[model samples]
Target: MKTAALSVSSEECFQPGLIPRSPRLLETLLANLDGMVYRCRADAQRTMEFVSEGCLPLTGHLPEALLLNQQLSFEQLIHEDDRELVRWHIGECLRQRRRFDVECRIVCADGSVRWVWDRGVAIYNATGEVEAVEGFMQDVTERKEAAQALQEAERRYRSIFENAIEGVFQTTPDGTYIAVNPALARIYGYRSPEDLIVSLRDIRHQLYVESERRSEFMRLMEQHGSVSNFESRVYRRDGDIIWISENARAVHDDAGTLMFYEGTVEAITERKLYEAEIRHQATHDALTGLPNRNMLHDHLQRAIQARQKGSMTVVAFVDLDQFKYINDSLGHQVGDELLKTVAQRLLSCLRDTDMVARQGGDEFVLVLQNQSGEAGIAEVMQRILAAVARPWPVGEREFHITSSIGVSRYPEDGKDVETLLKKADSAMYKAKEQGRNNFQFFAPWMDTQVSNRLDMLISLRRALDQEEFRLFYQPKLSLSNGRIIGAEALIRWQSPEQSMVAPDRFIPFAEEAGLIVPIGEWVLRTACRQNRAWQDAGLLAIPVAVNISPRQMNQSLIDFVANVLRDSGLAASWLELEITENVVMKDAEKTVATLHALKSLGLKISVDDFGTGYSSLSYLRRFPVDALKIDKSFVRDIARDADSAAIVKAVISLAHILNLRVIAEGVEDEQQHDFLRENGCDEVQGYYFGKPMSVEDFTLRLRDEAIRGAAGK
Candidate 1:
């Protein structure tokens, strides 16, 4: 740092203790001063005329050595590098008739360099002849070094500010740019900092894509004195959007008033895009490219919450029919294509606000929202069904597809995601039961049915393990001679915790829950053993009919029945397996083969509920069965319903034409029996003969009937 020398009068120079005759006190003060005090001749050498004792430390020499020319002159004491500079400053000050104030390094007696400030003025004689110069001299080496260090720090900081990669900026509180680095100009797509500063004057309105972002930045700065990683979308000079994060603080003046904001900025657009992709993968199904279960759960929960605000939300569980068979037959690659196609179809049937998520496999869950009755839910379902049913061509083959959908409404069918999904699933099965290719809304009754079915399924398994089941027989009497020729064994469940559960209450459920297969085997083994015991006791040789469920028939029925009979030591002829008419027609060829296999083992086969199925004369002629039992539904209306009576007669005639003995079941009155007897029905089994009874009761009845027949004969 340098400063201009001030004009100084002769009196001013004398005031610094340069009087011609100094008092003792003034002399002492001059000798004790912090710096060298001197009066020198105005000659070229500037030979010292007077010198204070302080010069000993300032120049590393005794006062006597410097006075006059006894030792090296003060002019020689000035460093070689600064001698000309010092002389020029002093000469310039003298020409201006002012004082000289110059800083230069002076060499000490030990040859060490020290910086000093020299200030002096010329003294004139009474005739205006320049006499000598007098003033104070101070050693300022430490101050000079400190100033040099500060200048070096400032230079390095400026270099770094120009070259840093991160965009650095300083702006006033009112959003005017005070300064910006070159990197900031490059990031914002400007030619230079000058171009950026001039073109983007209003930071609030011009820089940010979202108009309020700048305001938010200001607010954070106001509240916390700083904003770290404050991110936002911003517009570049070319109007392209980019993401940025800023770390800034409000710069304050000494009195704590905000002056400006300074910060560093980073472009984060690519990082933001990558993070979005990760989030999408986490929430979406990979195969179908639809929302996965994780997303479904979150979306459904949000919809359920929204239901509180008077808006309707529907959850539809869609299951593709025969998907497993198709997937297995065509391979997983085709299955994946099928799923992808169905997902697109489902999406087409829905609005942008609606969600269709792939729950997994062949199942998808749909969420429909804000459906006003004016714009019907049924209409949406119809569109979806039609979309799914469209012909899907895979390679050379074009195939038609179908789906079963169950709908559950928010705040009505259910109030939560899990409950709605579960109920919708149950209703989807009901759609399948109603013959597939349709949709059904969840009903309250369906819940009860589902709950009861679940409880019965658990109970059924426990019943098998605990022996809570027993078989009761209903006598099948011969219409020709009033003889007991056969008895149908009906299962009765006597649970330890509840009343006896009739077969009708749980039999269908057992079949659905896949519990009937094992239950059927248990019935077969138990009935065989009991029949063998009855024959050993010398009772009549009557076949006991154990009804086979459709589920059991699909399994290895022939082997299971043969195993039971062999184990029981019961002849196959005395154990008839009764199958429902519908069960036989399901897969007639397979059923026929299984029946023939059983017959070769000497077991008789009877078709139960004979009149209530897809029964054809050709199929009947083909079935190698011993008898056809008429379903109780028609028999219940036999006397009054002429159509019922006509149907019954036709069935009997059909059975006889096929050489199958015709039996009428569910007879509850004498009128029904008399009608069966006169109509040529070969056998009758009903409550009229006797309601289903225990084994002991059946034995007693057989003995009583035998006694009566003998007496009548």
Candidate 2:
């Protein structure tokens, strides 16, 4: 490593102290040399002639130990495995008369191996036979390790790119595939990455289903420098369409020059199909495969938004008349088939712009858009009436079905979905009232009727909670003795705002609103307790008859009635149930079973409003009843109308023959009373005996009767 004894090539590298000023500079430069400078003989031992001070640190040995093989030859410093390689390389370089450059590992004094770069040229005698060699060697372990690590990283990246599940790609900004991994090729239905890159000369035109899709992707990349979850439809190599989502970023060089777009793609066709199916199931009816109520609302709202000034959006609420009969007689399966058939017919009656949705069983809502006027709507309505009315054959029978349609026009009848549907429903009911197989246009006046009914229903719900309901007792008199036999319980509502809400005004509404059951139970409970109260007051006990609505006549009625009597401490014999004839006749078998069950409890059962319904003589014979109350319609006219008199007389005769008592109601005057008494009616309830009165007034009447009886005795 000593430069002083070497033949100097550079002018500044001279022997130490040869020039007084340059010697110090030369010594300083040699002392700071990065590696060991040495001279060795071209021999098997490679004996070192001179070595620099850096040899101690570079080879873990002093220059004196290595020079002239005083301790160990420089050849021994070479790793055992690299000794032959070093010798052969140096010999070849010398024979070629060139500088030798090689990288070899050397064993250090501490047993640690170090990578070294040995670079030097050989100097020879005047005959050109190599005489000696000079070289510089530096530790290169860090650089070697770094190069090895780079090789491993490249290998791992290639593996991932080849086998990744998601497609990996790099494409030019102008839409040509520059590089693609195996996964990308597979996703695009290509044989290999090379094939994919070669085939997709124009990525946008060949891959994207929409020609403008690539333009949008480029625009997004330019705006944001990245794109995430960019979903689009694209064609595969086989020309089949598939959905794909891409996550990508624009790649750039260090100078911020645009390079290419690199991204990952995920095939999502199956996910897209699954989501679409879920949406379809949500918006469509399972039974009829038509749009359901939710879809109807959505469609109607859209129609309302799209409705223009010169045109109309018509909403038609259609109801199949008496469809329950079909479901009750046949099965739900047949009913479902019929509904589907009706849906098709309804669809056929409208333009393509119109939508028909199943609101529910036997009911459909139609939204017709862009209609010119009532004439067009009317024409469509007529078509629906005829189409739905056509005979539908089920199994062996051909059944005729009809629909009642209610029409509401946008901006005229309503401007919102709820309002439009409600008005349409109101008109539909009006259509049914006018008679089925027809359609009705919604008028402003219809809202009045609908609102009143709705208000009355709302009030009825609060009536029980507010204690606004009262029970009035109308005395039933025995014609033979003219004494109170029993009193019928009637409900009356006293409203602070409307004075009095009559039974006829709210009872029917209460029935439709499912409020009748609770109201009916209250009446029964109150009447039973009142009859027991009269007996406690020392008055004669008589059965207190409370009317039973059809809705109240469920399987639980017997238990409810028994519980009421038990709670009131009233004997079963002291309560009578008066169900309307129509309720009893509606389902004869069920009515018979219920009536007999009540009769078994020792309470009297009677058909109220008799001679008013279609009661088969045979069914009447089996009814478990103690009496029949003649309807007021016949009784009111008995004195003036012969048909009414004959009908009344016939009902009494029939009751007598069946061993049942006959009571006539609405007998207001002498003639009506005379006719009933002469016809052998057992009891009468009318203004003649007494009108329905408050609890206190009725108690007074009962007390007076007891007083009169005592005086007579």
Candidate 3:
């Protein structure tokens, strides 16, 4: 922080009679002990007419000798560089008859440098003709140094304000963006500050996504005279919403009248994302991306508050049965996929207005708003059961898992969030007791098992290690050949100690326990390895498809798949990843990224259970999928049902239009197979041919097929 040196010389002076002065006033001012006062001719060389006593203190020259136009005049004391400029200023002021001020350096008689401020005005004679210039001078070395320092400081601040990384803004009291630095304009996605000002006339309405945000802002301003950490969702110029935080204050005038507000706006999109992820970690199931315990409590409370008369809110507690044995025996990888699949199916069953939350390990709570008592709740429960029962492809297998749903209604079950949740949870046990894949309304007698969740956890963990798991593969047939093309891997568990454990039983539990990440990795590796073994045993290298859980499909999945392919020595084209519709829909961009990454490794990507997911036709083209596998539910009735047939046909046409292959699953008869093949299905898989088999059994069957083929040739 350095500044240029500055000073004023005596020859630089110009004086004017802008103010009428009393005769004695000038004499009294000159008598004061600090600086000199003088009058000089407005000429090339300033000729002195008057000088004050203070001249002795600065230049060691007496006033009488300087004032009488002596040989040692004011111009002689000025630094040579400044002498002419000072006279020029005096000449201009005299000719213009205006006030003048100048600063320059002077070399005193003692050879010391001094800074001075010369304030002057033009002196005119009674005839209104220019005569001379008169002014007062001060030894302003200290003040001049301070002024130079201030100018430098202003320059630095101005530079930073213009080139700052974060946006800075000054707004009017009523929330209009008055002035915004360049950085702010960029942050708001505007081309320039002028454009931003012209377009964003009303910040509260134009910038904030919600109108009520203005009220919140005003409230904060009123309460605290300022606001910090004030976050709101706002729109960029292109209407893309982002989050920003403002540290702002109300600027007031001298009398405390409100002038305007000035604030610093930090584009916190990245920070907001990080904060949201942290919040997600705290209140969401890491594996399923569904709300967890803490968030569920908040949702329940909100539901209770929104409860309407006659139309009661319903809370359904869903628990997957037999999930533990599948996890322990087959591996946690299969278990995690089961949970993610279940979560997705549950989400598909509910409306966007409803809430589907995972309340830790095998327990899911759903909030149905304004339902018409038990009947309304029953329909939802049935849909939940159907969705859970629908076949899902796991690794290289296809299996089914069932859920037990317990319902509790507002007021009838309990009035409070916790009470309703507790009742619904207890009733879930009743559904489990009656039979899996059924729904039960809350009853007072079912309270006994509500507090036994710990026991359920223990049972699940034990199921996994006890070798209760089994694999079920659904057939995939070539449409042209009428032959099994491949199979989708699925898993099941039959527990000796517990009759049978469903995937829904322990999948959620493992996910909530953070065991899904490792578990999912295992499924990928195991399925790939199993497929490679089948190929090495002389079976046609059909794509062995494995479902990818969302948690496993992120960044790490890319590396994991590449590693598994290397270890198994399998070509990427031989492996297909069955990703559900919902996973791709959650974050279209990120999902596209994950799909591309897998695709880049030469693996085939298929949209599993295609019709059952939230489909955005616009984004379908962006997915790096090789095929769309129709859900079993659609294929189950595609042969006889017109609507199912229509949907199936449309999906096939759509898939073909997108250059994606179509595969039909759950074709239980020849008619279904004929219909699928006639519709140009690239492949078909279901009970029509064979169910899933062990790796050895599958290889033996392939050998038999090859022997048959050779005999026919």
Candidate 4:
């Protein structure tokens, strides 16, 4: 067997003893080396021929223990798991005559595990047979542990990116996506993350529904470098629009130069819709679906702002005329339907720029923007009036309703929204006062007039509570015999400060203020109690009639009357209730039902002030009345006015045909008395018989009348 010759320069090929080598230099170099330099035979248990001093620190073994395998073989130091692999690798490298490198674990003398990198070239003889292996072994445990840790951290991050609920994304500053997770793809309605990344090239155009949103996003990013809860509408892959919220930050390098944007996206479409619905409910009326007072105030404020820019706006306050009558008589259900219908009609009459809002109950505020003066406003007002007046069926019958609108123009009718609305409301009351179903523009003088009316309303309510109201009775005489049959009770207010206030002054105000219900109740109870007291005092037993206003008829009048009769201990036959002709015809069906209920209590029902309201013969026939009282207008001029004379004569004939007694009111002179008596009138109540007087005076008059009747008998 022969050995391969070493390839070296002649100057480098010297023996250590001949070259006079420095022992300290060699020892210093070898001690600082990371691993032990070795030469060993290629065997199953590699036989180490020589080893460096670095071996002591690397394997915790002395060089003598490893040399020639006298104490321990180098193969025994290799970890059990890597011994076979090490032998196979070394064998293959020796056969191919090439250098070999491998990583494996080794057990130190202390029984501790350490990872090492071993590199060697095969040493061969002249015949190409393996002789030995020479290599350096270095401890690489720190690098290996660090690399494994980095790999574990990457695995966790990838797992989180894949499984997160919120969409995660990385995009360039120019809105080009670099990476996207599955959640991001799902939010964008795409099949996969790769598909989204490929299809959405320009996020500004392909993702955002509005182009301006991209600009806004850029602006925010430039200003703050980050945005949290930035909400906007965006388009999906399917082109369906949805709302999304993003929390993002501009990713920058060490030099503070923007590299890309990384963010999270959340589908907030459902939340956005819910917020919109909540806003609508807050600003709109529940029943009529019109803008409510809150929204109206906002609109009016805007209108006022426009006025400052030299634009004219009309604030029209509309009130449904006689709505309370319909509400009280028919029911609130019908009233609600009527209000909804009115709202729709008002909307139809206005332009898109105009707004109509419910100010609450039968009252609506209309805003006419950029109006061209009175002419344009008038035209729209007329259309609204006509639309509201058009007959519509409610329940089973057709009903016709009208609106009284009051308008106040901006700059001319005060400056602010509150002032404009106040003026418009004042004008609406003027329209009502002037005979409703019309429109009125605000006038400065209307303020004083409305104030007076308001004062009267306050005073009237006080009078009712203070028991300052008194009932005055006027004797009703039989036209044929000139005998007292009954007395009509009239209300009068004896104010503590004003002395006396006429019924004409406060009654209308009471009706408008909704104070009439309680006042009417007081009048009924007082009148019935007086009548019962007179009969208990052994006076006349003639029935006493109480006038019922139209407002009173809308309430539970039958129940009130029944309660009054029961409380007063007066026979129902001795109490007669007189309702106006117009009241019964307002809601004919409801009135008929009420009249029947009242008549069932054995009370006499009379149609007072008849022939004034245009009552239909068909509905009038259904009324359960015992008497019909001719209105004062007809009786006042019966002797001279041929129209009045004919109406009175025909009324008597009509009453006779219907089996009802006819009574004429306001007969003040001899001629009026003669005409009514000659027309076969059953009873007459007027100044011609006797004027209305106080309770004490009426009691004395009743006593004298009773004595006179007894003398006549």
Clashing residue pairs in all predictions, respectively, total 0, 2, 36, 0
TM-scores for the candidates: 0.51, 0.60, 0.47, 0.62
TM-score of 1: 0.51
Candidate 1 weakest lDDT stretch, 10 residues: 1-10
Question: Which run of 10 residues does model 3 get worst, by summed lDDT?
Answer: 1-10
lDDT per model vs. reference: 0.86, 0.88, 0.79, 0.87
| Cα misplacement distance, residue 457 of candidate 1 (Å) | 10
lDDT-sorted candidate list, best first: 2, 4, 1, 3
lDDT tens string, model 2, 1-713? 35433324554344476754454565566558877888899998998876777787888887878878888988889999999999999989998999999999999888999999999999888998898898999889999999989998998998898889999999988889888899889989999999998888987889999989889999999999999999999999999999999999999999999999999999999999999989988999988889998998988998889888799999999999878657644545778889989988888877778899999878999999999999989999999999999999976779899889999999899878999999999999899889899999999889887888788888888888898999999999999989888999999998777887789978878867888899988888888988898999888788889999767876499989888889999999999999887778767788789888889889999888887655789999999899999999999998889999999999999999999999999989999998888879999999988999999999999989889888889
The predicted structure with the larger lDDT, 2 or 4, is: 2
Question: Between 1 and 3, whose TM-score is larger?
Answer: 1
RMSD to the hidden true structure, all candidates: 15.7, 9.9, 15.0, 10.1
The digit string of per-residue lDDT tens for model 3 on 159-186 reads 9889998888888877788888999999
Q: What lDDT tens digits, residue by residue, belong to model 1 across residues 507-619?
A: 86786577888888888899999989888887777899999876787688788887898899999889888988876776667767888888899988899888776566777
Query: What's model 1's lDDT at 636?
Result: 95
Residue 658, candidate 2: Cα error in Å is: 22
Best by lDDT: 2
- State in Å the error of residue 594, model 4: 7.1
Task: Kindly report which residue pairs in candidate 2 clash with one another.
Answer: 1-51, 1-52
Error of 1 at 123 (Å): 12
